[model samples]
Every structure is written in structure tokens, then in C-alpha cells.
Target: MTDARRASGKNHYLWGDHCDGWRLIDGPDLSLREERIPPGCAETPHVHHVARQIFYVLAGELTIQLPGRTVVAAAGEAVEIAPGQPHLVRNVGNQDLRLLLVSSPDTAGDRHAAEPPGLP
Candidate 1:
């Protein structure tokens, strides 16, 4: 959302909130990030600036909120999030939630970061 350049280390976050966790990857026109959801975690409604995001479940279960609907994505399954749509994610399983969240055009992760490094 800003013109400032951002960087991260290994296991870095492209961006996320309480209900979600993610790591940034390298690319152009497309930005890749590995996302995860911990057990008992969730988030409120949110948005992405431009990129269309897709969440592919690698492990555990994820409850995704869209419009007035909520869908469950199981392991090996995936869900797509369109640009400008308000959405959220929650972990509904007993185990840790794991997923690969790939966002194209690199604009899906423009949310402002609320936490600084080394925070709990």
C-alpha cells in the first residue's frame, strides 16, 4: 500500500492477521506465499488490493468466510478469493492448519502490519 520497500527473512510474512499466518516468496507479476492457520485461530473480515488469491490446503481444516457464506476447505482442496471481496479465515480443526496461499499480481497482501518483529 506504500511506496516503501519491504523485506523479510526465511519464513517471512508477505502479511496476515490473528487468524492467519504467511511466508513470502520470490517472483514478479505473481507473488508466492506459504500460509498457515494454527489451531483455535481466526480473523475478522478483510480485503486484498488487487491479486486474486487461492488457498490450497496442505493439512488440517480451514473455515473460510465469504460474503454471507462460510466454506470448509479440507486437505488437498482449495478455495479462491476474488479481488475486492471481503473475507476471513478460521481454523476449525483439532490440528494445526497448513496451506499454500498463492497470490498473483502481488497485490493481495497490501494489508497494514500491526505487529513488529519479536512480538508474541
Candidate 2:
């Protein structure tokens, strides 16, 4: 039988100025995580070398910025990012933002920061 993992039973990591991430499934080919970002926190824009990723909003709202566009994803909505696309996710609400991040072929050591035009 395969083991089941829950957020309460998984390992947690802190990142991005008070954000928390729980690794629900960590594998070489794929990874699934539940992440929480407090209001006003934003991830720096970056690109993945090979992994494509999807962000599913569980609670609150997420402002996802791409190279030429920005999208707002609310609860139950998801956004897909192609590999090599420069993007970032930010919590622009007053409450905590909970989301699920799914990465294919893994994202470990595959990220590179990039400067988006007109963004500091």
C-alpha cells in the first residue's frame, strides 16, 4: 500500500517573507506543494529551465505576472506557466493566500531569476 500524506503531517519550509510551503509530494519527476503567502508578499520573477508549473488557488487571491500580462486567480482557479516563461505570484489581498503548486519534471535547481521590464 502507498502512504498518504497530509499537510499536517508533511514537512514545512519557510520562504518569501513569512510564506510557508508544505511538500505534499516530492519526487524527481514531479512535485506537489501547498503554499501560503501572507498579504503583500511577492515572489521574485523567475524562469524554469525545464519544468512547467501550475498554480491552483485554494484561498484568497493571487496576482500572477507574466512577461506581457498579469492575471488574477481566485479560489478554485488555476494558472499554468510554460517552461522558460518568466513569472511571479503575489498576494495582493489583505488575507492570507493559500495555493497549490504543481511542477512537472521537478523544479529543484531549475530556477533562474530574471528582470522583467518596468519591474524593479
Candidate 3:
């Protein structure tokens, strides 16, 4: 049986600087989550060894810093990150940034912190 899940009523966790995340689906092969990032907050740069991820923005703006460029996704937009890609997520807007993070093959135990590209 499948049940409805909402961030407000799901398993919530905090990350980064005052960020919030709720796991909507946590299966062994796939993971889905709703994440909220306060303004001016950013997650540490990291890479997934095998899992590919997609960030779909639900509200505000999402800025993803990649190796040589930065991608910005506003409401109704999404960014796709390939496996082994080192990227950093940031909330550069004034309001709260809300997005759905989807990972295939799951990311648990596969994340490795990495230095942002272009940094000496």
C-alpha cells in the first residue's frame, strides 16, 4: 500500500546552515526528498560516485555551482547532475528556496566531499 507523504508530516532533517529536508521516498534504489534552503545558505561541494541527481525547483531560485559554470534554476525549472560531478547547491535569493531532490540508485554512502572547481 502506498501512502501520501508531505514534508510537513514526513521525516524531517536539518542540513547545512538552518536548511530543512524531508524524505518523501527512501528506497534502496531511489531517493526523493523535499529540501528548503534559507537565503544565503549553501551546501558543501560534493560528488556522488554512482548516483545521478536532479534538482527540481518548486519555489524561489536555485543556484548550482559546477566545475566551470553556474546554473540557476527558478520556479518550474530543474537541474540535472551526473554521477561523479562535483557541485554545490546555494540559495542566492532573498526568500526560501524549495526544491525536490531525486537520486537514482540512491546516494547514501556514495557522497564524497570535494573542492569546488577553479579553486586552488
Candidate 4:
């Protein structure tokens, strides 16, 4: 994850809003993606082929909506998603939502993400 205090460093993407830090922790076991999503921004709906995902809310609350149910996860809470399950996330707060998302099956890079119908 990019240091919040790092003033003169480059970040992951061009939101100018959310700060992100990504690293390959294990050689072939898992990966970590740290993100800070500004209010009103949301991640597109996607799926994994052979891996499971765990989303942990570090600071702010996040609204996670799967195909069947929608749940609000507060800070220090976590949610697990099994393989082939389609899911998506949204930041429904006024503050930046800091989150840690981990994915498995990193060795084979078996990821299958699809954009939602309304999204480009």
C-alpha cells in the first residue's frame, strides 16, 4: 500500500481521489490490494474463476451487494466470497473508505471479471 504520508510518489490509478497500493506478497499463493475509495466511486462487478476473495474493511463502511443479498460492512468487518461467485462493491459514505482485498489462486492467475450491464 502507498504511504499516506508519501507526498512525492506515484499511485496506482488516476482517480485523483482514491489512493491505492498493490503488492505481490506470495510467490504463488495470494495477492493484496489496498485501496482508498472516495465517496461515490464503486468497483465494477466481477468474478473469479478458481479463487476465493476476502474483503476486509479497515477504516470506513462499505456496501457490498451480491446477486442475492446486499450487506453493509463496517470497519473491522470482513466478508468472504467463494469461487465463481459474482460480486461488487460500493462506497456509500462521505469519507474515504480504506479497504484490504485479498485473492487466492494467484499462482495460476485465474481471474474472470465481467463488467455489469449498465457499466461501460
Candidate 5:
């Protein structure tokens, strides 16, 4: 029998200054994680060589900076980031941002740090 997983009960890790990540499902072909970012925190811009990812908001707000566009996703909204697209994820709201990150073909060993154009 397969056991159910929850962020509070799963494998936990920290990343990107006060951010929390819980591994919900981890596999070679696909992976899912529950991530939380405190207000005003952001992750470094990066690109995946072969993994495509989706960020689905569970609560609060998400601000994503892409090549030339910015995407804001609230509760129940989602945004997809294709492979090779440079992007950064941030929490621009006063409250903490919570979201589910899903990646296809997994992202391990496939992520490359990038400097997005135009902004420092």
C-alpha cells in the first residue's frame, strides 16, 4: 500500500533564504514539491535543460519574472515555465506564499543558473 504524503510529514529542505520545500513525490520522470516563500523573498533566476515546471498557487501570491514578462498568480492560479526559459520566483505580498511545484522529467542535475535579461 502506498502512503499519503503531506508537507508537514514529508522530507523537508530549505532553500533561497527563509524558503521551505517539502518533497511530496520524487521520481526520475516526475516530481512534486510544496514550497513556501516568506514575504519579500525570491529565488535566483534559473533554467532547466530538459524539465518543464508548473507553479500552482495554494495560498498568498506569486510573482514570477520571465524573459520579458511578469506573471502574478494568486490562489487557485498556475503558471508554466518551459525548459530553457529563464525565470525567477518571488513573494511580493505581505503574507507568505505557498505553492506546489511540479516538474516533468525531474529537475535534478538539469538546472542551470541564469541571468535574466534587463534587470539586476
Candidate 6:
């Protein structure tokens, strides 16, 4: 049997400067989450060894910083981060940023934090 999921009814946890995340789908092969990032805050740069992820913006704007450039994903836009690519997500707009993050093969223990921007 399949059960419908709703963000309002899902459990949320705090992450990174009061940001919130709700796990919409949890499984071994795939994971889906809805996240909220407050203005001026950012996630740390990191990479997944085996999981590839796509981040879809639902509200406000998201700044995805990569190796050589930064990608601005406005509402209704999405960006993908391939495995082993170091990246970070930030809320550069003056409002909260809402987005859906989908990970294939689940991140699990595959996250590796990289040095922050402009650092060696």
C-alpha cells in the first residue's frame, strides 16, 4: 500500500543556523527532503561519494556555489550536483528559501566536508 505524504504532517529537524528540514521520503535507494534556509545563511561545502542530488527551489532564491562559479536558482528552478562535486547552498535573498532536495542512493555515510570558499 502507498501512503500519501504531506509536508505539514511530516517531522522537521533543525539544521544549520535555524534552518529546518522535513524528510518526505526515506529509503535505502532514494531520499527526498524539503528544506528552509533563512536569509544570509549557507550550508557548508561538501561532497557525496556515491549519491547524486538535485536541488529544486520552491520559494525565494538559492545560491549554489561550485568550484568555479555560483548558480542562482530562483523559485521553480533546479540544479543538480553530481557525485564527488563539492558544493554548497546558500540563501542570498532577503527572504527564506524553500527547496526540495532529492538524493539518489541516499547520502547516508557518504558526506565529506570540504574546505570553505577562498581557503586552502
Highest lDDT against the true fold, candidate: 3
Backbone clashes, each candidate? 1, 0, 0, 0, 0, 0
lDDT of 3: 0.90
Q: Which ten residues in a row have the lowest lDDT in candidate 1?
A: 111-120
Candidate 2 wrongly placed segments (more than 4 Å): 1-10, 117-120
Q: What is the lDDT of residue 50 in candidate 2?
A: 98
Q: Model 3, 34-109: lDDT tens per residue?
A: 8989999999999998999999999999999999888999999989999999999999899999999999988989
lDDT of candidate 5 over 1-120, digit per residue (tens): 122344346487889998888888999999999898999999998999899999999999999998878889999999999988899999989999989999998999998999963442
Against the reference, the lDDT scores of all candidates come to 0.67, 0.87, 0.90, 0.70, 0.89, 0.86
Q: Estimate the Cα RMSD of every predicted model relative to the unseen true structure.
A: 9.5, 4.4, 4.0, 4.2, 4.0, 4.5
- Position 70, candidate 5: lDDT: 87
Clashes of 4: 0
Instruction: Pick the winner on TM-score between candidates 5 and 6.
Output: 5
Which pairs clash in the backbone of model 3?
A: none
- For all predicted structures, in order, the TM-scores are 0.70, 0.88, 0.90, 0.75, 0.90, 0.88
Candidate 6 lDDT, 23-113, residue by residue in tens: 8898989999988899999988888989999999999999988887888989999999999888888998999898999999899898999
lDDT of 5: 0.89
Q: Which portions of model 5 show Cα errors greater than 4 Å? A: 1-10, 117-120
Candidate 4 lDDT, 1-120, residue by residue in tens: 235453234434333335454442544678676667778878767777788878899988888777757878989999988887777778889888888878785614565576552421
Best by TM-score: 3
lDDT of 4 at 31: 69
TM-score of 2: 0.88
Candidate numbers sorted by lDDT from highest down:
3, 5, 2, 6, 4, 1
Ranking by TM-score: 3, 5, 2, 6, 4, 1
Candidate 4 or 1, higher lDDT:
4
Residue pair clashes in candidate 5: none
